[model samples]
Target: MVTIEPIMIKGHFFTAVTVCLPKTTLLTISNNTGYIMCGALDVGLLNSRLVDRKIIAGRAVGVKTIDELLMAPLESVTYEAEQHGIFSGMTGVEALLQMVG
Candidate 1:
């Protein structure tokens, strides 16, 4: 199953997506500029192999839902995310705000 919905954070509009697979679910919240995702995201690949894309994203481990992903501290972030002031240990919400700002 796949679910996608609009989300409002501090008056900013974003999209939340949930995809249920056989054994796991993938969760992510995104705005025009960047996104935060569950552990399935590969921050290392974004930073190294896909560095030229300049993808601004963060990953939070042990997150089962979009809400948890939004509240959890980021386990890792892309280099582009770091350029935007989003860092490991930052809450997903905070990183998102930084991405927008």
Candidate 2:
């Protein structure tokens, strides 16, 4: 399980990980004002250490940086290809906003 410590990146905000899902799938919310990852790491508990996390499911690989996790050419995975399951058809800036929540 990849447990991300509760950190206030850049000191501007904190992530309230309400649900730790096994898969980062998607479902829309607030009429598209915001979106949520269906299954992800649980990080939204109070007074909790990040070490207390479990792994439900994931690929054999992981990367912490966008650059390190270079994907295939943009042409390979169409914008639509990545939208349905994991991101609800969103990526780039849109996807970043979801994570920043």
Candidate 3:
């Protein structure tokens, strides 16, 4: 199953998506500029192999829901995310604010 919904954070609008597979789920919250995702995201690949894309994204591990993902500290972030002041250990909400601020 797949679910997509609008989310409001500090008056900013974003999109939250949830994908349910056989035994695992994929979760992500995104705005126009960037996004934060669950462990399924590959921060390393975004930083290395796809560096040119300048994708601003972060990954949080052990999160089972979109709310957990938003509250959990990031395990890793893309280099482009770093450039935007988003870092590992920053909560998803904080990183998201930085993406728009």
Candidate 4:
């Protein structure tokens, strides 16, 4: 079993440092606002969700993961306008880490 700890440091961009114990793995994920991306995303999964170019930010820094972010606690941010939480359990992202790192 894996434990999930979602943390939020900024809002302009959503950043999370996911730590997996027992396995002793760590991932630093930075994604745009609702416009998000990560270093731990899946190419195939992202390709499957090919949306619009305008919707996807060009400043994607990390790898693309099929895993969706686990929603960070509302207390993590002040953006009430956003419906989708910034951070959450990213099953896909975590799996990618397991495979890659």
Between which residue pairs do clashes occur in model 1? none
Q: Write the per-residue lDDT of candidate 2 for residues 32-91, one digit (tens) a residue.
A: 222222222222321144323321111111323332222211111212223332233333
**Across residues 1-101, which tens digit of lDDT does each residue of candidate 4 receive?**
33333443332324455555473343434444233334333333333454332222211222322133332211121122122322223232332232222
Native-to-model Cα distance after best TM-score fit, residue 97 in candidate 1, in Å: 1.0
> What would the per-residue lDDT of candidate 1 be over residues 25-99, giving only the tens digit for each residue?
999999999999999999889988999999999999999998898899999999999889999999988988897
Flag the better candidate by lDDT, 2 or 4. Answer: 4
TM-score of each: 0.97, 0.19, 0.98, 0.26
Per-residue alpha-carbon lDDT of candidate 3 for residues 26-95, written as tens digits (9 for 90 to 100): 9999999999999999988998999999999999999999999989999999999999999999999999
Top of the candidates by lDDT: 3
- Comparison by TM-score, 3 against 4, better one: 3
Clash count, candidate 3: 0
> What's the TM for model 3?
0.98
| Residue 54 error, candidate 3, Å | 0.2
Ranking of models by TM-score: 3, 1, 4, 2
Model 4 ranges off by over 4 Å: 1-13, 24-28, 31-40, 49-101
Q: What is the TM-score of candidate 4?
A: 0.26
Report RMSD for candidate 4: 13.5
What's the true lDDT of residue 34 in model 4? 30
